[model samples]
Target chain A: MKKLILATALVAISFGATAQRYFSKTAHIKFFSHTSAEDIKADNYKSTIIIDQATGAVQVETLIKSFEFEKALMQEHFNENYLESDKYPKANFKGKGDFSKVNFAADGTYSVNVAGQMTMHGATKDVSAIATIKIAGGKIDGSTKFYVNPRDYNVQIPDVVKGQISEKIEVTVKATLQPLK
Target chain B: MNKKVIIIVLLSIIAIGGGVAYYMWNKPKTNAADVKPNYILPADSLGAAFAKNEDSANAKFVKDFVALEIQGVVDNVFVNEGNESVIQLMTNTPDYAVKCYFLAGESVSANKGEKVVIKGFCTGYLMMDGVQMSKCALIK
Candidate 1:
């Protein structure tokens, strides 16, 4: 009976060790476009991110309509015309990186390269980015920046306002992840 | 004289259209303070619904910018990167809570653990853990 109890304890401990996934629901994602005529910026704070400490895999999901612009008309135009967010509601990224260089148990900052597929507006593209990850006081903070073209995601701009929007949009992501229980 | 009149009418139409477009591009936003909430419930109730099924909660609360009045204890109060005040309300479940982003220049007088009612536009669930509400106004 004692041997059986010990075996059960060992199994429970192993299960606990595998539960090293970190999650953040309040992550922020901002996209900016600059042109000679105007500069447009939208912020979305409802981004969801998960990072597996054991495997160095990361996943991020963002709701397109959650992005808020300063102007209501710009928001409406982005949803109705540019992104068609009602049709394609979400954008997601899944990537893998080498986390062997950093120790998850220690508090420090590590820069890593993540390569993944980004899916948005019913189109998927391969992307690689550098993410700065910091572990401090039992929390994981990460930030990254990347650039994307709307045309690559099947987002078309009418000729009338083409000059007002830039071809490449700069996207910035920030997250403070907490360990999942 | 007919040609001149036609040109004048065309120019007037173009000018009017330009003015309307400009007005639309710079129209004033709806005041959240004046709008009535579409739904009212406790923060725990909303969090529970989202925890149970994210897709359903999103369909009901997020598809249309539904306004909500949620009551709960203050879990955290902080400012975001945009320098906007945000209040985090605690729920029954751990890691699942209501995050309220207040409008610019708005302030909350409530401290942590104080029960407060907030009204805002529900942006739906953030993953399986959080309910996001923006442009929030405290209703005591």
Candidate 2:
């Protein structure tokens, strides 16, 4: 009986370690803007995420000023005036979801929603994001997209130059989530 | 010699005055039509719809444009502010000048005696000097 108990404890510890192992740093983030006059796009969001399997939790963060625009001045104004990257430099999304329910015997599709606080421009809002995970060849792929507005975070503009900026800004995310080996 | 000096002075004065007049005549001027019509988010207004209090009644009520007849200062221009509003755009282009993109809202003036229609989004604003604006635009 003691031998069996020791074996069960060892298995539990091993499972804990396997569930929360560190992952390789390889993920991508992008954003796009559309307007009547022009459809401008910037894809330079550097992102990082830390997942804790034991606690069923995850944390994701990316810089706003990293977005590259066609014009340097607009980029400057974007960080300084619009998004205020100086005041609110980073945009973060951290939430919890379950990963243990996978029916590993047969590979298939699963949908999950991560509900947490998305902090941007110094404002923390409760955001529920959906993730579509596709499993194949012992690897997992994930993707998500959402929208944001400048005014929500207190980024303000004056009246004189108001015509140059759009009302709503679109933010999108795509990443290849891989488990720790 | 005195008479010649006086005559030269008079000619020089005439030449300087003529040049000044010509320069003034050729400088770029803006008429009411030259002042373009566009959207501008007001400095004092409501915030965006996607805001955290996104469901708040105030956010939905803040209109994008305010129509009226008055003079206001927009980029140092003094024209009859039209019924259409003004809004600002976010850009890095070299003063694509008036090619500014705007939000839909209204605003107070930087100065007086200027006419305009300000269009912009409402946003919460707080400054180090205790200045606050409920709605502000990202005017280019």
TM-scores computed on chain B for all candidates: 0.80, 0.27
Q: Find the candidate with the highest DockQ and give its number.
A: 1
- List the lowest-lDDT window of 10 residues for candidate 1 chain B: B121-130
lDDT by residue for model 1 (A26-141), tens: 78999999998999999987688988867879899987867878998998899889887656767899998776566666799999898899999899999889999898877779
CAPRI quality level assigned to candidate 1 from its DockQ score = acceptable
> Residue-wise lDDT of candidate 2 within B45-121, one digit each (tens)?
22222222422422332222321111222443211112112322212222111111121223324433333443222
Candidate 2 Cα misplacement greater than 4 A, ranges:
A21-24, A102-107, A158-166, B1-140
Write candidate 2's Cα lDDT for A1-181 as tens digits. Answer: 9999999999999776666432322245666667666666765423556555566676776656445565545555676777765455457787886655543224677776767888887888776667665667767665667676666767687776555456666666655555654
Best by lDDT: 1
lDDT of each: 0.83, 0.47
Point out where model 1 deviates above 4 Å. Answer: A1-26, A86-89, A104-109, A134-141, A176-181, B1-19
| Best-matching candidate per TM-score | 1
